[model samples]
Target: MELKGKIAVITGASSGIGALTAHLLGQRGAIPVLLARSEDKLRAAAERITGEYGLYRCDVSNSGEVEETIAKIIAKYGRIDILLNNAGFGRFADFIEMPVEEFGEMMNVNYMGVVRCTKAAVPHMLERGRGQIVNVASMAGKIGTARSAAYTASKHAVLGFTNALRQELRYSGITVSAVNPGPIETEFFKLADPSGDYIKNVGGFMMTPQYVAERIVKLIEKDKEELDLPRLAAAGIRLYGLFPRLADKLTYKMLNRK
Candidate 1:
């Protein structure tokens, strides 16, 4: 698929993979529409883009903001050719110890955020009969891990939504895809795992945001159904699916690293 002149809207674009992906998209001739809660970060990110782009202060958790921002983008750009739902965060904690409010917040942002953005973008894509939607999920979505019950549940919801939505838009000329990557070197750990035990435990296996961003761009270009990063981790997910009991026994130590 040619990316030239495509209008791509990316959530969580203020930094991390979202920010880098916006820059990469621009390099491919796509007009990136950046959205995040931080207006200052958005402004800084926008200035760094090498080509055409749009910036919006949108909190995916708020329906009003998401709907309004999508409308504004369509109003200005004429249509949205790509929608990347990447606005999400994680906080690792035991189910009993985790705050109830934090659990709700995770669900609102990680899962419902994808829903809100996709819901708002679908109509416009349907009208044009063409577009692509990419939801950034995680490895936790595939295999449950210790000390990450809430975060895993939220990601699991994202995967469920992504699968159903993809089938729903099967012939709508719009492709829906999900990218599931393991831990990456980013500020995400600052909030997700404050003690940094998880990062230290799997430091060698961690990937960089730029590496994942490149794959995301490729996913959009190819319109792939799903992408699981860092081939080794993806294999583990598949193994767990095929042999749950054995996987649990073999991965006992690894899963508890967090």
Candidate 2:
């Protein structure tokens, strides 16, 4: 959709993909509303945008906060043209050793955050019968691997929800799309692997967050259902779906390489 004058709400807007999108969207003439838990960071991010914008301190995992924050935004803008669900975090751990609390936190922020924001914003979109909901799921959701079970599970839930919503809105003007990208260069690694094993080993192959953000903005202007970035990774994902055993062997070698 044309971003000019469009009211766009971006979750996880404090940094990384969300922050970059906020700046880029503002450049495209969209009035970007930034949402995240950090007020300071949100303010800083909004300041970096060159056009008109606003920021809200929102913890997407909190239903009441998301509901109230989103309501205020809608009340002011009167219409929302885009909702980008990008607030998420991850960690590397053996499932058996991962704490239940950490797993629940993943579900809360990574999966339920999307649900909460979407729940609040979608009704407004439905009223207008024109909007875009883009969930930033991960390649991990499509192809599981060792060391990130909880993270993968949360993203899988996101894709499931996105697919269901897209089908439900199939005949309507509202569109739901999922962007499944491989690892991008971001603070996520420090958050995911404080010990740095995952970053030191696999991070070099990461995609640039700017590249992913640009592609997402372009996809929203199209009729695409989903986007799997880094075409090679997309191909590998398809292979894993078709031949799990072969994929397991290949992935083991790939991850161990270097």
| Top lDDT model | 1
Instruction: Report the error of model 1 at residue 112, Å.
Output: 0.5
Question: Ten consecutive residues with minimal summed lDDT in candidate 2?
Answer: 249-258
lDDT string, candidate 1, 1-258, tens digits: 799999999999999999999999999999999999999999998876888899999999999999999999999999999999999999988889988999999999999999999999999999999999999999889988899999999999999999998899999999999999999999999999999889999998899999999999998988898999899988888888999899988988977798
TM-score, cand. 1 vs. native: 0.98
Clashes by residue pair, model 1: none
lDDT of 2 by residue, 39-75 (tens): 9999988888987998999999999999999989988
Clashes of each: 0, 1
How high is the CA lDDT of each candidate model?
Answer: 0.93, 0.89
Over the full model, what C-alpha lDDT does candidate 1 score relative to the true structure? 0.93
TM-score per candidate, in order?
A: 0.98, 0.96
